[model samples]
Target: MPSTNCTTIYKLVQRAEDDDIEDVGNQLFGDGSSTMSVLEKKKRFEELYGVVRPDAIHAHPPNVVKCKGSGSRLPSKVEAAKKAAVKPPRRCGKCHKMVNHDSRNCDKERSKKQK
Candidate 1:
C-alpha cells in the first residue's frame, strides 16, 4: 500500500467512514493541501477506487445477538467463584506459620537444634 502514491491512497481513504481507513489517508498525505472537505474526499475516493468503498456491495452491520448473552451470573456460581479465589493459609513445619521461615532457615528450629 505504501508503494502506491500517498495522494492516490488518500483519495481512496477519503470516502471511507471507518477510522482505520481515514487514518491511512492522514498518515500518507497528511491533512494538508492534498486533503479536502468530506465531499471532495468522497469524490477523490470514488475516482481512485472506482466505487464509494470496496466493501459497499456487501456492507451490513453484523447481527451479534448470539455473541452477547443475557449478562448475569447465577448467585451460586458467583459464590463458588468467590470461594475459589480464597484459600486457607499453609502451615510451615519449621516456623509453624506461613509468615516467615521454612525448614532449612527457621530461627526457632535453629535454636532448638542448638540446644
Candidate 2:
C-alpha cells in the first residue's frame, strides 16, 4: 500500500499531466473548437494573466507596507525638491534646434560643445 504523501504526490502529478495534455489539445484544436484560432486563445490567455502566472504569484496592493505597524512613507523633502527642480529638455524656437535652454537663453557655443 502507498503512503498518504505518495498518493498525494501521485494525484498532483496526474493533475499536472492532465493540464499539460489539455494545453496541447488547445494548441492543436484551438480550445476544442474549429471556429477559434490558436492565436486568439493565446491572446485571451495573455489578457487574463498580464505577465506573471496567477497561481505562482500572489496579488498585493501597491501601497501596502510589508513591515508591521508602519505606514507607507512619503519621499523626503530634498528628493521632492530635486524632482521639482528638473526642467524639461528645451528647444530653440528661432532656430528650431534642440538645446539646453529655450531660444531666449540659448547658448550657441555651449550647444556646439555638446556635440
Candidate 3:
C-alpha cells in the first residue's frame, strides 16, 4: 500500500463521517436537500405556515366607580364611624313608619286611605 500521511487519513475519516451524517439525514428527511441553513429553514417555515397569534382568553373588564348627586363623594373614616355609631331607623315605604322589615315585606295593617 502507498504511504498515506496522518493528515490525509484524518481528512478521509472526517469526510466519511460527514457523508454518513448526510446520508442519514437524507434518509430521515426527503432527498431534496437544499443548502439552506437552520435560520433559513425557520424563515421558510414561517413564510409557508405563518405565525400564530395568542388570544386574550383571560381578559377582564375595567373596574369603574361612578359618583352621582351632591353627596356622592367618598366619606372620611371619622364620618363613616359617626354614621355607623348613630344607626338611623329604616322607614317602611308602605306603612311610612320606622320598622325592622322593609316596605316590600311589611306586615303592618293598611289604612283605609292606603286601600
- List the candidates' TM-scores in order: 0.21, 0.28, 0.25
Which runs in model 2 stand beyond 4 Å of their true positions? 35-115
Give me the displacement of residue 88 in model 3, in angstroms: 79
TM-score preference between candidates 1 and 3, better one: 3
> Each model's C-alpha lDDT?
0.67, 0.71, 0.68
lDDT of 2 at 111: 69
Among these predictions, the greatest lDDT belongs to 2
Q: Which consecutive 10 residues in model 2 have the weakest lDDT in total?
A: 47-56
Order of all candidates by TM-score, from best down to worst? 2, 3, 1
Q: Is candidate 2 or candidate 3 better by TM-score?
A: 2
lDDT of 3 by residue, 1-115 (tens): 3456877898999999999989765644436755666666655556545783344557888886665564858999999878866887688887788855577677543542377
- Model 3 TM-score, 2 decimals: 0.25
Model 1 clashing residue pairs (backbone): none
Quote the positional error of residue 105 for candidate 3 in Å. 94
lDDT of 2 at 44: 64
Best by TM-score: 2
Residue 9's lDDT within candidate 3 is 91
